[model samples]
Target: MSLLFKELDYRPTPIGVLSLRRRRELSLDIDVYEIKLDDEYLMSSLFTDAEIALADLGLADLAGDSLDVVVGGLGLGYTAKAALDNPKTGKLTVLDTLPEVIEWHQQGLLPLGEQLSGDRRCELVHADFFGASLSDIAGMNPQRPDTRHDAILLDVDHSPGNVLHDDHKRLYTKDGLQKLATHLVPGGVFALWSTELPEPWFEENLAAAFDDIRAEVITFRHPLIDREDINTVYIARKAS
Candidate 1:
């Protein structure tokens, strides 16, 4: 049974109310008029290692004065925030399906957004990462070169196998991966943050889409208040 909802904290952002929910377990939820759990607040969700790795995998290759990054999920804005922290990154466009999630950042529920959004380097868009068309991304920054993303970091669901939303499974499918391929520049890296190692099928699909496909298993300790959990990250790159 869940305990009485206790307030851990709150932030105002693009999503609106970003608050920590203290029940039997700590979770992060958002609300404008209704409540929804984005992920287990302060639990296994906020894995910094995965977030940093996602950003680094892409930034490491680019030599240009300005690098552009596309982040598929904005959970607490950790990955997006980390990308912005990098000097090599010139712009970061974060897309999330839930507008409320964007509000959470815009309103300042996550302080990282508050710090990074105003840098003129961060742009947040409300749309499904999978459904977002190439035209849509191009519209965000018209001057951006064709096949613009230097890095594509996706933290959409738990993993390719353990999907929270049915539609997300497409991301690991061949067709979905093909779409991703179109967005990435030559040699650009695609990083996926997963709760665990993805199925072999995911690797096969990635291989079929990109010339060089690889996965990196990253283990890190969680910063939860109660228990410690180890999380993993999967990194796949497009062959130059």
Candidate 2:
């Protein structure tokens, strides 16, 4: 591998080939880390405004300290770090279906791995977030089964319409959302990150199970294109 680019690790997962890589950006004089699923780039360290915003916007909706939060994806640990950064956050449970991703953090392979894993407030767990969302008994934290949280931030799929797996499609529906709501404390916040623009139909589905729904568009500079790009963060709160 060239000094500018290196493939750190690769593993075959049920969904696809999971890989972690690091590359040097001479133009910016910075090191960039990336996670990939086969040919598709799952996440990059350079662009994480939306991921951070997912946690910010979600936790911002709630009022109180010692907030119990659950993040539905591990990715590059951007969202998890953001949640832990908030002083209001007390305990954070991060759930991901892939054990490799969770191991990357525990082994300190990723950039934010050490920061997230070292924090006593954060717990990285190997679990299917989508499956837990629809489950009333298991909830987001399998160890603390049936326990509700103050905030639930999700960034697993690309978008409500464009899901990574067919099984994830159910969680986007009104019925699926209603089931997810049961996992949250009353008046708790639920936020989601999407690469595409927010759709009205999805907002309608969220409304069925939540109140004070808001679709926030987060704009950030695209590192590759050197132009503005946008991602959506959907925030909703369960009825009190």
Candidate 3:
């Protein structure tokens, strides 16, 4: 007999209802963990190549033996987990606007939560990535107020023009880009995962704010759809 578990966890978040579900796939004969916001599916364990690539592509050029990094958003823990997997990453700070999401990681409600929570190098912080001011982040670290991380991996919103919340749209602007650049060390990199490819205005904005910039398309096969879909990762290197 095929076994299935129906202990789906759902909680009301400020934005909407957040849910975490784990169930057995009859045909696949495996467990799949999924997260949803109201009626919209946020993420699933079934696909994580691009999420891992966000960290991989961002920190590709970092030559140092030890690096301090920050990741915005803790969706399925794939990005943070990828950063931890890097031998060069000395410290990792993950920020998420949703407290319920953080609680899921701490409570071991997800597959990778126990491992991520147990890692001494990883710090899961509850903060708004875009809304935070210099002083606010300085509060997270008294010494380094201006530049803190070697890389900042962001997967918070849909894209530059598209956002998950009203307040998050500002981060896509030139002014917002300037604030994020201050967090990276000299020659640091910023990578953003987007459901759509880079828009012209957004690409121009990044070029104006940073040095070299690249937009990559990640194509993957989706069995459910029986077709291939495309996602994008925008990478920009901060001026040294």
Candidate 4:
């Protein structure tokens, strides 16, 4: 391997061939970490504003201490790190479908891996976030399956309509949204990160299960293209 690029780890996942790579950006003189599923790029360390905002905006809505938060994806650990950064967060549970991803953090492969794994308040679990959200008895936290959380932040699918798996589509519906709320406490928040703008139909379904719904458009500089890119964060609160 050249000094410019290196493959940190590669594994076969149920979804696809998952790979973690680190490459040096000659133009910027910095190392860039990227995750890919098959040939498609899943996430990159260079672009993380929206991931962090998902935690910041969700936690900002509630006024309390010792907040128990759940992050639906563990990609690069940016969102998980942000949740732990908040002083109010007492426990942060991160769920990812692929166990390899969780192990990467535990073994310290990603940049934020050591910080996330070493944090006393953070717990990384291997599970299906979508399934847990819809489970009648089990909540997002595996250790305390019956306990409800203060906030659930999701960054899994590309958008409400563009899910990575077919089963995830149900969670975007009105009925599924209602079930997801059952795992949350009254006044708890559900924040979703979408690659595109919010859809009207999704908002209608979100309204059925949540209150004070807001779609936040977050913009950041695209390092590869040198242009502004946008990601939407939908924040909704359960009825208190």
Candidate 5:
């Protein structure tokens, strides 16, 4: 079998608690790491299917609506790239908490980063999405008027039920969900990528925040290998 990219060990300075590795495929670079505490295979570049699903399914109907999009995680830049592919997207904002992740992308570890960064429509912010203030986003491009986003796609951590940080659990709570809902313009959409099926309670919580909600299982064939895998995509639309 042919390999996409070669894997190289990566260790970020100062954040010595965790170990990360990167591999370069024919066109894309993948990062694999063991996050501290949980010790789970915290993240990988293998599941870009989930990322694209978040972008494609979430913004499918809003094709030419002059939309602003906010993506919570910048993993591999797949979601951001997919979102930018839509002509309907007027502005694209991506938020990530890890400076290392951003730096890696900026330095060309992720092949798509340079193109996305160079795009006049895309903005990359290094901050925790949950803590980002509305004013901060509005300030990104002062020339453009402040407008609530048409879609928000979040893939910060794992599914709500399988979160790596205890604090992230609040993002799934009623209050947290309400905060997310408030950021959306009327009739806007919110999409989340889940590594597994979300908990029943979490699905109910999503229903409470939006008037319409839909969940689908997306199957993808591995880019290099023929193996098939599935991930969950949750899409909700704000009430008009």
Candidate 6:
């Protein structure tokens, strides 16, 4: 089979230069859609295990029906789509700082964009998630105020310590995390997907803000690298 490669879209945004590229992986023998923020790779359709897992494992502890959720980042729509797959999910609102990224999905630029946009349960908002905390939770819900969700899934930065933007650093702190919990219900869950391994210090920060804080190391085989790889997803519950 012939290799395929192309830069589908590229534009300047407040964060940096956002790009959408498609490349065929010879080993996998399939096309892979990838998104990039400046020089850093943001997401790829090829390895969506961790992204989808972010929704599945994060919301695993949730109970009852009519669930409301807020996904902090909308990379390639994998996590959003996964959340919508849950039958109990009543509404899934996605918040992103980049307007262009949201536009890409609305315009059917990304692979799962059309499906996610067409779903009544999924709503993409153009706003800075990191900036939204207890001090200033305005504009987070867009249509309503003081809208708390059952689960808040995050996958914006690399990790609690490794952030793509400097502004994101505060979101990992105890104070920032405490503020984040204000957007959730008393028993709501905060799930964070990180590229770094499980860090005890980070868990300590989470413990200070919430209860039942735990980190799970997700291991999977990388077809591209032909080796085993690992990532972490931090799960915590707000005070009940």
Error of 3 at 16 (Å): 1.3
**Candidate-wise lDDT, in order:** 0.66, 0.92, 0.82, 0.92, 0.73, 0.86
After superposition, the stretches of candidate 1 with alpha carbons farther than 4 Å from their true spots are 1-46, 133-147, 223-229
Q: So what's the TM-score on candidate 5?
A: 0.81
Estimate candidate 5's alpha-carbon lDDT, on a 0 to 1 scale: 0.73
Q: After superposition, how far is residue 153 of candidate 2 from its true place, in Å?
A: 0.3
Structural similarity to truth (TM-score) of each candidate: 0.75, 0.97, 0.92, 0.97, 0.81, 0.95
Q: 137, model 3: CA deviation in Å? A: 4.9
lDDT score for candidate 4 against the true structure: 0.92
lDDT of 3 by residue, 1-240 (tens): 424856468898778998888878776777888888998888888888889999999888898878888888999899999999998998888888888888888999887899889999988888877765333363223234454778889987877778878887767888778777777778988999998976889998888779889999998987566788888999999888
Candidate 2 positional error at 217, Å = 0.5
Alpha-carbon deviation at 44 in model 3, angstroms: 1.2
What residue pairs clash in candidate 4, if any at all? Answer: none
Question: Which residue pairs show collisions in model 3?
Answer: none
Model 2, position 195, has a per-residue lDDT of 94
**CA lDDT of 171 in candidate 6?**
79
Clashes of each: 24, 0, 0, 0, 6, 0
Candidate 5 per-residue lDDT, tens place, 80-136, comes to 998998878888988877776677667765568688878998888777777652333
In model 2, the runs with Cα more than 4 Å from the true position are none
TM-score result, candidate 3:
0.92
Instruction: For candidate 1, write residues 158-179 as lDDT tens digits.
Output: 7788775676777788877877
The window of 10 residues in a row where model 2 has the poorest summed lDDT is 131-140
The total of clashing pairs for model 1 equals 24
| Model 4: CA > 4 A from native | none
RMSD of each: 6.1, 1.5, 2.2, 1.3, 4.4, 1.6
lDDT of 2 by residue, 1-240 (tens): 337999989999999999999999887888899999999998999999999999999998688989999999999999999999999999999999999999998898888899999999999999989888887684589999967899999998899999899999999999999999998899999999999998999999999989779999999998777999999999999989
Error of 5 at 99 (Å): 1.3
